[model samples]
Target: MWYRLGQWMLRVILRVYHRAEVQGLDRVPRQGPFLLVGNHISYLDPFYIAAQLPQRISFMAKAESFSHPFTQWFLRKVDAFPVRREEADVRAMRSALARLRNDQVVGLFPEGRRREAEPPTELKGGASYLALRAQVPVIPVWIEGTDRALPRKGRWIRPAKVRIYFGEPIQKIPAGKNREDQERIHQMIMSAFRQLAEQKVAE
Candidate 1:
């Protein structure tokens, strides 16, 4: 399958070129449906996480990415689905819920877009909604140096050192919360990545 092939290639390429240093990988749940929330600094973030993770990841990507045939094919091969980033994508939400019910790991970027800024300026509600609705554990990940390898508005692949820190599941979000409560939870998720960045993590 395309997903398997992509994963294999990614593992090799990342290990050989980037010299990726991953910490707290065991924090990821070995089984069952869980959410991987992190800062999206570059296009390579998802692939980087996929390579380091032990299980298959059903990644949630932007809908516009599927507009082209080649892109669509590549994404499909890697078990990734597109979600419209501009508005509330109910269909994508339903699709994500379905995958969660099927007990697959789903990766989402709460920041919505690839941001080079530390502690992303804004966070989206989709991640919080899915986490509460599915009653699944949410693991906060902090990825550094991907933006240098592949910037949002830059081209040309460059070799760079990358590190990913997978923090333990954040129990800040709960069921049956109001809008204000939702925003608080979203901010909490964002803060986790920033907090991790400040910590002295062992490689």
Candidate 2:
């Protein structure tokens, strides 16, 4: 399958060129449904994360990335689904929930889009909402050096060292669907993300 191929190829390429280093991969649950949350700084962040993991991650990607026919085909092959970044995409949310219910890993970038700023200026509640709805563990991941390897507008992927950190799974989202519950869950996810980022910075 293309997903397997992509994963294998990415692993080889990242190891050879970027010298990618992964930490705390064992922190990931060996099986079952979970939400994978991470900072998005490059277009290749999803692939980079996937290459180091033992399981498939159905990442929610921005809709624009699917505009081209070839890209659409390839993204579908890799099990990625599109999400409209401008508004609340009910269809997308339902699809994500369906995947989670099927005991699949769903990856999300709570910041919504690729950002260059450290400590995202804003975080979306979709990940937290999905976590609450599905009652799945949330794994916070942090990727470093992808911005330089394949920058926002760069054509070539220049060689650069990349590192990935996976934090402990967060499983204690407060039980409820209220706005307060969502905010608390959102903060919990972001706080874990910040801790991972801070660890990378401390190195």
Candidate 3:
């Protein structure tokens, strides 16, 4: 109920303020558990994506955000759970796995933390790890113009046109050595995101 209400309110606000555009939603699979991975630009990336999508997505929030009572409460209201980013967070992984097993869509920022680097140099292996383990498809999402609207340090949000592109899912990972395999999946996802971003620019 909270997720639904939040989505409704956010949709109204994003439409009115950002004039956000969404494309390739039809590329998303209609059913079953899938991993939705996106490039992290602004803090609004996850929320913006969530508001635009019809179904619920379980986003991984940073664990520190849960330390404060109000933030934890608010995060819970929106159906987000915390993940420790410093090292391997067993609890968060367990939570994500459980959700995936239940046929739920899990959203992740493969770059690990929020970053603005184009063609990111290094990407954390969580998305690849989860997708390979869960044996589900990975849907690559590309979001644009969010940095201009709300940046990492900006206190005030300026109205900026935003666009999101959803690409087809990558179903199978090449079988090989573990490290090499994860790296392959990581590159593929990042490449897909760059493609979507490039496509958006051409339009």
Candidate 4:
């Protein structure tokens, strides 16, 4: 299938060019309907994560990426769906949840958008909300050196060492929780991600 072929190509490319160094992959749930929450630093962050992961992971990409016909086709083929980020984008949420319910891995960048700087930035609450709604555990992943390899808005990709650290999944949000609890869940998710990102930088 096209998907399998693409994945294979990605694996080969990453292996040769990036020489991806992944750690703590065992922390990722072997089988899941799990949320992959991580910091987004470069355009290739999603693809880098996907290359290391064995599961079929889908990312919630920005709507603009899908504007071009060829780009849209490729994104869908690679399990990426566009989300109108200006607003709540309920349609995108539904599609993501449906995939999770079917026991698929869903990748999310808590920042909601890519950053141009070095250190990871503050995260949005969407990742927490998705985990809570889907009733699935959130696996916090921290990727390093991606920006150096493919800097933000840079056309040329320089071969660089990249590392992916997978931390244990956070507790799922309780059912029937009140609004206040939901906010707490969001804060907890962000805090956990912050810690993970910091640790990755320290290593």
Candidate 5:
């Protein structure tokens, strides 16, 4: 119940302070394993998404964030596992795969780092790799206004409106051992991001 309480508290804070709005939550699978793939903008991105979803998502976070004792403890408690960006972290991948095999949701930001101005054209391969390995549905989530709510380097949180869009899942990646399939999946994710952004614009 620490997780439930935290989710409730975060939802309250986000709704009241940022006027956060979430769309397409019904698109999320009610049960079973799935991968949540999204762009990283601000430090608050994970928190914003996590606050809205009832299914607890085990997010893959950067290893550096786990360096601090308090942060490590908190992240562990929240079921977040650290990833070493500089290399192919087999351990982290194993942990993620194990979780997915257990029919748990795994959250990942394929961009590898927070981007401010431009849309992500390139993404790390880990996301696609995991998708291929787990053979699970890939949910594309688009988060907007988070950068304004909490800028990349800004210390203070601003009262900017936040919106999250969840797109339909992409399933069935062709079996392959080469990088071609991974690239295809990556392109699919990029296309989904574009569509979600257009959705936000049309609104």
Candidate 6:
């Protein structure tokens, strides 16, 4: 299948070129229906995570990425679904929730968009909302050196070291809470990611 081949190629490429180092992979739950939240720095973020993760992860990508026919085909094959970034894309949200309900892994970039620098900015609340709605665990992943591998708006790809760190999943959220409670969950996810990023920086 295309997805399998793509994952294989990614693994080989990362190993050969970047000397990719993945830590705490064992922290990721074997059985999902969980949210995989990570910092986004490059176009390769999703692929790198997918290649290293044992399960097939579905991404909520910006709608524009799906505009081209070939791109759409490839994205869908790799388990990415489009989301309208400027508005609440209810259909995409529902699709993501459905994937979670089916015990699948949903990859989300809480920042909502890729950043050009290391130590990404504040995260949006969508990932938290989805995790709360689905009553699933949130896995925090921190990726390093992706910006250097393929810098923002840069066409060239260079051999750059990349490291992925997976923190333990966040498992607390009260059922049927108010909006404030939801916001707290969002903060918790963001905090976990921030801590992971700081750790990477220290290294």
Structural similarity to truth (TM-score) of each candidate: 0.90, 0.97, 0.92, 0.91, 0.95, 0.95
| Residue 201 displacement (Å), model 6 | 1.8
How does each model score on lDDT? 0.84, 0.90, 0.85, 0.81, 0.89, 0.87
Model 4 lDDT vs. the true structure? 0.81
Per-residue C-alpha lDDT of model 4 across residues 115-139, encoded as one tens digit per residue: 7534444666677677778888888
**Candidate 6 lDDT, 1-203, residue by residue in tens:** 77888889999989999999999999888875789998888998999999988789999999999999999998988889999988878898899999999999999898889875555557776887897799998899988888999998789878999999999888887586568878888888878877897888788
Q: Judging by TM-score against the true structure, name the best candidate.
A: 2
Task: Compute the lDDT of residue 52 as modeled in candidate 1.
Answer: 80
* Model 6 clash tally, residue pairs: 0
Candidate order by TM-score, decreasing, is 2, 5, 6, 3, 4, 1
TM-score of model number 4? 0.91
lDDT of 1 by residue, 1-203 (tens): 66677778987877888887788998888888888898888898999888887789989999999999999998988889999999999999999989998998899998888876476767889988888778777899999889898876778768888888898787656667577766666777877887777763433
Q: What is the per-residue lDDT of model 2 for residues 1-203, given as tens digits with 9 covering 90 to 100?
A: 76788789999999899988999999999899999999999988999998887889899999998999999998898889999989999988999999999999999898998887376757988998999998899999999899999988899998989999999899997788889988888888888888988888899
Model 1 clash pairs are none
Residue 137, candidate 5: Cα error in Å is 0.3
Whole-model lDDT for model 5 versus the true structure?
Answer: 0.89
Could you tell me how far off, in angstroms, the CA of residue 38 lies in candidate 5 after the best superposition?
Answer: 0.8
The Cα RMSD of model 4 versus the native structure comes to 1.8
Please list all clashing residue pairs in model 3, or write none if there are none.
none
Clash statistics: count for each candidate: 0, 0, 0, 0, 0, 0
The alpha-carbon lDDT assigned to residue 123 of candidate 4 equals 67
Question: Whose lDDT is higher: candidate 3's or candidate 6's?
Answer: 6
